[model samples]
Each structure stands twice: as C-alpha cells, then as structure tokens.
Target: MKRNNTFFRSVWFIAISGLGGFFLSLTGLSIGWMIGTFLAAALLSFLKPSLLRHDASKKGVPKYWLFIGQCILGIELGQKINLSFLHIFKEYWMTIILMLLLSIFFSLLSGFLLWKYSKTDMLTSFFGTAPGGLSAMPGIAEEVGANTAVVSIIQTMRVFLVILTIPIFVSLWASNPVNHVTLPAQTVSPFEFEKLLWTLVLIGIAYGGYLLGKYLKFPAPWLIGSMVAVAVVQSFGSLFMGHDMVSWWPHVVITLSQIFIAASIGSRFHKSMFIGLKQTLIVAFLSTIGLIFSMIMCAIFVSKVTGIALITAVLAFAPGGIAEMTTTSVVLNADSTFVIAVQVLRIIIVCVILPPFFRLLNYWEHKKHLSSHASA
Candidate 1:
C-alpha cells in the first residue's frame, strides 16, 4: 500500500480516534485510552474504508503520529527510571537474561506450532509469534519476504490479548510488595516556568536520542532511543549537576501519547487484512493464550529465584508492549522501572538476534518447498 501523505485528509479520522480514546478513558481501565483509540480507528477503517483510505492501494493515517506518540511514551517511561534501577539491573541482570531467553524460547515454540497447524506460511507464523515490539515485527517481516499483512494482523492480535488479559491477571493474583522502588518527591507545579524549561530540554533530548538510535539502527528507535536518552539524563542529572531534574510531568501528556499510539495502530487494521486468515487467526489466538500462560509460569519461577515481587516479575516477563506493561505497573503500584528495563532488554534481544534467525528459517523453508515441487 502507498503511504497516506496528506495530513489534512486524516484530520477527521484523528478526531474520531481521540473521541474514541476519551470515551474509553471513562471506563477507568488503566490502558483504556489506548485500547479505545485502537478500537475506534480499527472500526472506522473496517466500517468506512473510504474515509481513511484503508485499502490495498493506500495506507491509513500518517506514520508521524505514531512516532510522536512513541516519543512521548519513551519520555514518560524514561522519567520513571530512578537511580534504584541501577541497583535492580545490577542485582538481577543474570536472572533477567535467563527469563528473557525462556520467554523467547516459548514464543518461538508457539510460532512453530502455528506454522505446523495453521495454513499460514513459516515466515508469517514465526514473525507473528515473536514478542518483539508490535511496530517492529511487521516491517522486519516484510523485508524478509514474509506476509506483512498476516504478520501485522497476528502481532496486533497477540498484543491485544496480552494487554487485555495479563495485566488483569497480575493485578488480581500477584500481591503488591511494600518494598516498591520509590522516586524522589518533587514539589513543582506542572505550569512552573522552571519545570516547563526542563520539559522542553527533555523533549529536545528525546529528539536527539531518536536520531542517534536511528543511526545505530535500533528497533523502534523513536521509542527506545528517546527512552534511553531521557532515562540517563533524568537518572544521573543530580550526580553531574548537583540538582535533581524535574520529577513531575503532567498525566495529560501521557494520555495524549496513548491516544496517538492507539489511533495509529487501529487505523492500520482493515477487513482486507483478515479476509482469508480465519484458520490462521484461530491458531494464532490459541497459541497466544498458551504463550501467555507459559510466560506467567516462567515469571513465577523468576519471582521465586530472584525474590522479586510476583507482579513485578509477571509484568517484566509478560509478552506485551513496553508502554502498556509499564503503565499497568505504575497503576498497580508495582516496580515500573524494573518492568521497563526488562521490556527494553527483551526488545533489544529480539531485534538483534531473531530477524537473522527467522531469515535463515525462511531460506530453508523456501529451499524445501522448491525441492518438493521439483520432485512433484
């Protein structure tokens, strides 16, 4: 599909997306703003394809909206990073690595099952099942000769399931520990000039980080790059400058981020993407449930071995988007820093290692298919 280059044509769609987010926010769900926006955009695309140009010939809303949303989310998560994150990372680094490996193993296993049982091709199944960032997998899969439509649909479904189920599970079953990582208190108003100045600086830093991340070829560079840059400056500003950076940002900003992200994602969905994916969708759905369950059990083990809170372990290891899981952690009073750290590490590992591995698999699958046809 061609890019949706005209921003003016997208205004009405964006407005409806925001309205969807606003109404969903009323549900009091921690991630309702995102989910509501996603549903609205998706429904609009599916119901009235002409309005958004959600068809085979053209794309939906512009990509900049999602990038801006990710930048804001990265900054929000980066601010949650306190000096205590250093301690947590230092102490549980090995455990974190092991849990990530286990999670990836389960993800691949699920993908294998999907490929074997469903009618989807190997590349699509594998990329769809990978717990990499939702924004990264489809594009990467497309580059490697996978079905981008299938990968995108499946990846979105997986994230949607994880978002709806895992958070609720952790909140209900896992106990919140009293030893939460605490942030330093700030007594500044949101509209204070000093706070506003620092906020502007942070925004600039986010852009710089994004540029650096893009140069380094980081997956989801806007999100990860801005996150790391903001986190480092926010976490260590006191040691270098003899003063803590502003500790408080407005909640409305994060809400806006959620709306942008949700709208962008929802706009990507159309009936065309799901036309012949019935069997594949069913298989992917079941495998996703199994994958989520497997991760929960792994989280249980990680919690027992590392002495981390169960809820923290669950959120850290669960196969969900970084922003969604971190937001849930904050709402439930769990360890947000730890969750973000693990989530970031998971994305890094998956992006660095899995793409080439999946490409190898694709090659072998193609070879085998050619051989079978030759014999026939």
Candidate 2:
C-alpha cells in the first residue's frame, strides 16, 4: 500500500511537470519540454522537499526508466548516422581539426577559470566545463574522481544557457528571423513483421553492448555502447541494402525518453546543493558565458575560412548536446549533417582524451604536493 501511494505521487508530480513543459514548449522555447520539466521538478524538490523524499525502501523513479531513456537516445542518434556524410569532411579536414582544437582550448580555459575562481578541484572543473554531451559528462566526471554533483549541476547549467541563448542570438543577428526550431521529417519504417523482428534484434544488441561496455568500464557505458551497436548495424545494413535505414522509434517514444531523462536529472537536485556553493555557482555561470563567447568567435572564424553559413558554423561549434544542436540546425534549415558530424567528433575526442589528461593532472598534483612536503 505504501509503495502504491508513492508510485501514485511520483506519477502526479511527473504529470504536472510534463504539463509545465508543454506550456513552455507552446512559448517557442527550443527543447522547452526538457528545460521546463527539469526546472519544475527541481523547484518542487527545493520548495517541498517532503513531496519528493524517498525512504530507503522506496525510490522516486525506477533506475530502469533512465536506462530506457538512454537506449532511446542511443537509437535515435544511431539512426542519424550516414556513412556517406564522411565525404563532406574530405575537403574541409583541416578546418574541422582546427575547430576541434579551438573547442578544446576554450574548454580548458573555462576549466581553468572554474578552478581558480570557483575553487572547484581541477578534475571537477575540467569535466564540468568539457564540451561533451550532458548525458556523457557527469558519468565521465564520476569515473575521473570529480565531484559528481557539482559537475552535473554546472554542466546542466551550461547546456541550458546555450540552448536558451544561441537561438535568440541567431535570430537577432541573422538576415532573417530565426523562428522556432523543429526536427526535420524522419523516414520511419512501417510496423511490419520484419520491422518487429529488427526491433527486437536491435534491443538485444543494445543490451549486449551495454553489458560489454560495463565489462570494459566505458564512460556512460550504456549510452555509448548502445549507440555503437545500433550505428554499426545500421551502417553495415545500409551498405548491404544500398539505402539508408529508416528510424523505428516513433516520435512519442522519443518524447517519453526525453521526459524520463530530464525528470531523473532534475529530481537528483536538492536545496542543499546551494547551501554553500554561491561562489561556485556564480563562477560557473560566468565561465559558461565565457565559453559561449569563445565558441561564437570560433564559429565566425570557421564561417569565414570555410564558406559555410554563419548559422551552420555556430550550430556546429556550439557546446550544446548533439540532439539539441542538431534539432536547432534542422529548425533553422542549417547544415545539420555537418553539425552532427562535428558535434559527434568533438564528443568522441573529448571523451577519449580528457580522462587520461585528468589522470596526468592528478599525478602531477600529487608529485608537487610531495615535493613541497619534502622541502618543508
């Protein structure tokens, strides 16, 4: 009976939060459902903590919901992978590398600012300011021994600011008004026996990949693993079939996935996160603004050098997540293929490089401390 009551209350809270998101989406906000729902849930968790509190025996939402969300997101991204798009980079390889380097440089600068000004540890600052996807960063932070809560909060704030500001900036600066962004039409396979078989096969592959990633200890293992599994299958299948594979997940399913992810992240925040973190929060906000500015400048440089439109370049260079940035590009009729490619490339590079770099930093810091102690 107690479990039933808790379930009902959670459903009510999520429903109200979804409604809030719906209203916000009506206001022309990009990714409003995610932002609105998250804010609504976080506010509730802050103002009426008792309403969201869970005993040791009962949890607010099942962990499997989040895993399902990650799988949905992975499959969505996998469906977007077009092997032919690799040809687009042939002529612009140099510019792409330069943009990626600039992205790393700006992230490092932001991390330094956070470390010095916010007094966050070096590892947390680096991971928090990393330009990787929000889905990946917090998990990576935990792996690197960073302060997960602070990293998650700061990374979330950075993404929220980028999504809120970039569209408005583009609308104001562009020759035409940037209207509300919408996802491009996707080709979806019909509900047939073959499609059902493929869906089950894909789910099995995702699960297998998740287990393998867990064994290998990959950051955001479920996410990256499922993405790789689906993408490889889709890519090879398309090569053999001589056509692109259609998306199997419907729109409603994707929306539900987003809601699950957003609500889970939001509910993790509590009022205590703010008790003694004023300076850190303020520094995070300012560093995020700085990071945005730096990326904008890099976008302009890429635009001038490569002859791509400013909007496309901005979306490509934006530190926002792949899903959000790609959606923005589609809505604005920007070069979405290029945007996704660059964003994915950047994420791969960051995830591969940052962890080792962080370990080196840790090693050096330890050595320096020991040297000082010996001198003393």
Candidate 3:
C-alpha cells in the first residue's frame, strides 16, 4: 500500500512536469520541453514541503527516469550517425582538437577566478566549473569530498544557461549563414516487421551496452554505451545486412525523453541547497557567463578557420550536454554528429584530466594549511 501511494504521487508530479513541458512546447522553442520541465520540477521541488501533503511527494523523481531518458536520447542520436562523420573528422581533426583544448582552458580559467573570489573551496569551484556533464561532475565531486551541493547547483546553472542561450543564438545566426554543411536527416520508414526486428535488436543492444559500460566504469554509461552501441550497428548496417536499418521514431518520444531528463535534473534542486551560498551563487553565475563568452569567441575563430557555420561551431564548442546540443543541432539543421563527437570528447577529457589535477590541488592546499597551523 505504501509503495502504491508513492508510485501514484510520483506519477502526479511527472504529470505536472509534462504539462509544463507541453505548454512550453507550444511556444515553438527548439528545446522548450526540457526548459519548461526543468523550471516546473525545480519550482515544485522547492515548494514541496508547503505544497505537498505527503513525504513521498517531496522526494525527487527517480533516477531511473533519467536513465531511461538518456537511453532513448542515445538511440535517437545514434540513428543520425553515418559514414560521412568519418570524412568530417578526418578533414578537420586538428581544428576539433584545438577547439576542445581551448574550451577546457577557458573553463579552468573561470574555475580559477571563482576559486579566488568566491567562498567556495578550490576543489568545488573547479569541479563545478569544469564543463563536465551535469550528471558526471556532482558524483565525481562527492568522491573527493568536495561540496556536492555547490557542484550540483553550479553545474545545473551552467547547463541551464547554455541550453537557454545557445539555441536562441544559434537559431538567429543560422538565419543568414552561408557555406555551412548541414548533415542529412535520418531515413524514416513506415512501421513493419523488418523495422520491428531492427528496433528490438537496437533496444537489446542499448541495454546490453549500458550494462557493459557500467562494468567498464564509463561516465554517463547509459548514454555513452547506448549511443556507441547503436551508432556502430547503424554505421555498419550495410556491411552486415546490405541496407540501412529502418527507423520509425515518433517526435513525441524525443520530447518525453527531454522532460524525463530535465525533470530529474530540476528535482535535484531544493531550497536548502542555497541556504547560505548567496555570494558563491553570484560568483558562479558570473564565472559561468565568462566561460560561455570565452567559448563563443573560440567558436567564432574556429568557424572562420574551419569553414563550419558559426552556429554549428558554437554548438560544437559550447559547454553543454551532448544530448541537448545535438538535439538543437538536429532542429536547426546543423552538423549534429560533430556536436556529439566534440561534446563526448570534452567530457572524456575533463573526466580524465581535471579530477586528478583537482586532487593534487586539494592535497597541496591541505599541506599548506597544515604548515601554516604549525607555524602559528
């Protein structure tokens, strides 16, 4: 009986989130579903005690919702993969490398400024500002005893800012762009047995890949694993089956996925998390803006040098989620595959390089504090 009640309350909360997403979708924003769901979930989460009648109502949306959303989104993106991505990467690998490195450097600079000026400790500030995926950073910070609350808030803020701003900017810029490559849309076929067989196969692969990724300890395993799994299948479908896999995706699936993911993120926010961090919040906001601006400047340079569209380059270089940015790229008719590649690479690089560096900084800071105490 208790479990049933909890399940029902969760359903009610998700219904509210869906309504929010639906209304926002009516406004025709490319990523309206996500932003609206996020805002709604956060508002409800912040007011849960006063508005909700049950303790279960105050609990966050389940993590499984996020996992499922990521899985669906990974499949969606994987369907977009094709042989041409190889050519794009081969042609501009150097430019891509430089842009990613510059973006990381800019984020590190912003992290440094936040550390110097804000009340947040160096580790929290750096991890918060690292442009690592929102899902990845808070967990990593917790392992190192950094302030996970602060990391979550700042990472959420950065993703929010990036999602809200980049789409509008890219849409406007795309209006007058010339000489940019727009990737081909996925081939859609009507529902049939062949499509059904392939869909089942892909779903199995997504789940299996996720488990494998978990075993291997990949970051955002559900997303990365499923994406890689399906992409490989789709990319080599012709070699094995002598034809492309038929995809019969509904547009609503993407919107629902966005809602699930966004709601989960928003539900993480609580009023208590911000109880005593006014100064830190303000500095985080400023540093995130600075970081965004720096990345935009870098994107502009890359656009000029690589001949990619300004909007495409910006999406590629933006410190945002792969799923969010790639969704925007698809909606705006930009090169989404490039955006995914870069976003994935950036996350891997940040996860690999920054954590150890931050650990070293933490150790050195600890040592310095101990020496000063001894002298005193």
Candidate 4:
C-alpha cells in the first residue's frame, strides 16, 4: 500500500477517501465518517510536499476541486429552490427590510472596531466582518476595487476560525437546546447509471462554466459558474426530484461534504496562520454573540407582531444565511423561513451599503498613508 506523492496518486487518494467516508456514513457511523475522511486527507498530506505548485495559467488544483465541489453543491441546493415558494413575500418584505437594517449596522460597526484595533486595512475589515457566505465575500471585495488579496486572506481566516470554534462552543454553550441528529446515508446509489450519468453531465457543465469564468477572470469562478448553472437549470424547469424534508442520503452527502470541505479548510490552520488567534478569539466571540443577540431581539419583536413563539422568531431573526441558519432551524424545528428572510435581507443591505463604506475606508487609508509620507 505504498502511496506516491504524484497528482494522480492524489486523485486516487481523494476518491478512496470520499468512498470511505461515504460508506462509513451510510452505515450510520456519523462521527467516524467525518473523522475518517479528514484523517485520510491529513495522512496523505504527510506524503505531499508542503506546497503542490501548479501553474495558474495551466489550471490549478483549487480550480478543479472547487468546480467539482460547487457542482455537487449546486445539485443539492437547486433541488430546494422553486418558483412556488415566492408567494409568501406579499407583506413580509417590510419586516425583512427591518431585520436587514439592524444586521447591517451591527455587523459593520463590529467590523469597524476590529479593523481599527487589529490594524488591518478596511477591505480586510469588511470581509472579516461579513456574517454570510465565506466563499462569497472575496469576489465582492475584488469587484468593488477594494483590497482583494488582503480581504481574501481575512475572509478565509475568519471562516476557518468560525468553522473550528463555533461548533465546539455551541456544543458547550447550548448543551441541550435540541438533540443533534446524525445525518443519513445516500439511498440513491452514486453508482446508479441514471444518477451517475446526471452527475457527470452536471459536473461537465459545472467545470465548463468554471473554465469560462476563469478565462473571463470572474473573481470567484466556482461560485459564478455554479450559481449560473443552478439558476439557468431551475429557470428552464430542469429540477431534480425534490427531497423537501431532507432524507438520510442527502443528509449523508451534506454531512460528508461538510467534513471534506471543513477538513480541506481546516488543514490551513497551521501554527503559522494563527499569529493572533488568541487575541482574535475575543473579537470572534463578541462579534458572533452580538450579531446573534441582535437577531434574537428582531425575532422577538417579529414574534410579538406575528404571534409565533419567541424561539421560532429568534431563530428566524438570526442573520445567518439560508444554508447554515435554515438547516439549523429545521433541525431544531424552528422557523426556517423567518431565518431565511432575515439573512437574505441582511445580505442585500451589505451588498448595497458595503461598496460605499469600502470606498470611504480605502480613501481614508490612502489619505492617512499620504499624510504620514508627507510628514516623513
């Protein structure tokens, strides 16, 4: 069982690793499935050079992996969205706006302080502070002519921090808010001819779109490509067989996906990356707590207005996006829609408010540097 460090070896390693995780999860060994895949990758990395250099011009590892990952993710998410769900928004829009308004102010204010105190630039501050998609912020930062590189690093760092620490903290803090259920295994065989064919087609389109995006220099090629594919397919009524209540298999896929994704993300947490993790812990804790607490208030207010329970309203009020927050809400049997509304609203506010704030911060930074240089 000698494993070489070549790229082909890595592909075999990943496939074997994914299969191991998938089967382990299929048997209801939830924790093992997660740990096994991660350990597989980690052990493989011991054989890998610290850096596997690839030419950006020749299409690197990140592109291919992300293309595959995003396609799988799209199939999962695309199965959820339907035009029929849009009818509940006739009056809820105002409350949604209010939720977003508060989330924006609180999130930005939190970021501003951390930025100033951490002595990081404004773009880094904004991305670091962003409360939504870890994969989405860097692209937006680049688009608005902000500090993309620094912001990307900051965003990645924050995501890593949250993914590692938040679950541990929640396990301890909430203790028994709800029993966390283990995800189920895939019942529809991955090897089934129909499924395999569809998956390949989806993967093909995803990768094709991804290459096009890279050539076009889209800031987040995978995101752009996957989202485009998803939107187009859904609009054209090419939806997959819906799994509304989340069966064991998709649950298995998602759980395993998170582990793969998380482990891949967590591998970045070497000692070198955590120069200030201890100091940043307070900021992270406070920022999350404040944002969550604010959402709770919004939830309470909305609940009083709508006659839902405080807990459901609060769950809905929390500003985390549809994916993370909604899933948690569903597991807890709380108000997932309310949560979705609040998150969507908040993202809209950030998209609108951030460009101007980012520009202001950049201008201020440039002026400060010029003044210092003049004095020198």
lDDT-sorted candidate list, best first: 1, 3, 2, 4
Q: lDDT tens digits, residues 186-243, model 4?
A: 3454355555555555556666766776687654456455545544554344324342
lDDT of each: 0.77, 0.74, 0.76, 0.51
- Could you tell me how far off, in angstroms, the CA of residue 290 lies in candidate 1 after the best superposition? 1.8
TM-score of candidate 4 to 2 decimals: 0.62
Between 2 and 3, whose lDDT is larger? 3
Alpha carbon lDDT at 332, candidate 1: 76
RMSD of each: 5.2, 3.7, 5.0, 7.1
The prediction achieving the highest TM-score against the true structure is: 2
Model 2 misplacement above 4 A? 1-16, 47-62, 139-149, 168-193, 351-376
Minimal lDDT window, size 10, model 3: 49-58
Give one digit per residue, the lDDT tens place, for model 2 in 1-376. Answer: 9767766666676776677678777765545676677677667656654555464122345455567777776676665555654555666678888999998988989988888887688888889899976666665565566765687778879888998888777767678766554556545567777776777777787788788877887666666678777777877777788876554566677667667666655565655445567788899899899999989998988888779999999988889987778778777778888988888778767865776687788789889989999999
**CA lDDT, candidate 2, residue 233:** 85
Highest-lDDT candidate? 1
Q: Tell me the spans in candidate 4 whose CA falls farther than 4 Å from its real position.
A: 1-6, 12-63, 119-121, 134-218, 232-260, 263-270, 306-309, 319-324, 337-376
Q: Residue 88, candidate 1: how far off, in angstroms?
A: 1.3
Q: What is candidate 2's TM-score against the reference?
A: 0.82
Q: Model 1: residues >4 Å from true position, as ranges?
A: 1-5, 53-57, 121-123, 132-189, 216-220, 231-244, 321-337, 347-376
Q: Evaluate residue 272 in candidate 3 and report its C-alpha lDDT on the 0 to 100 scale.
A: 59
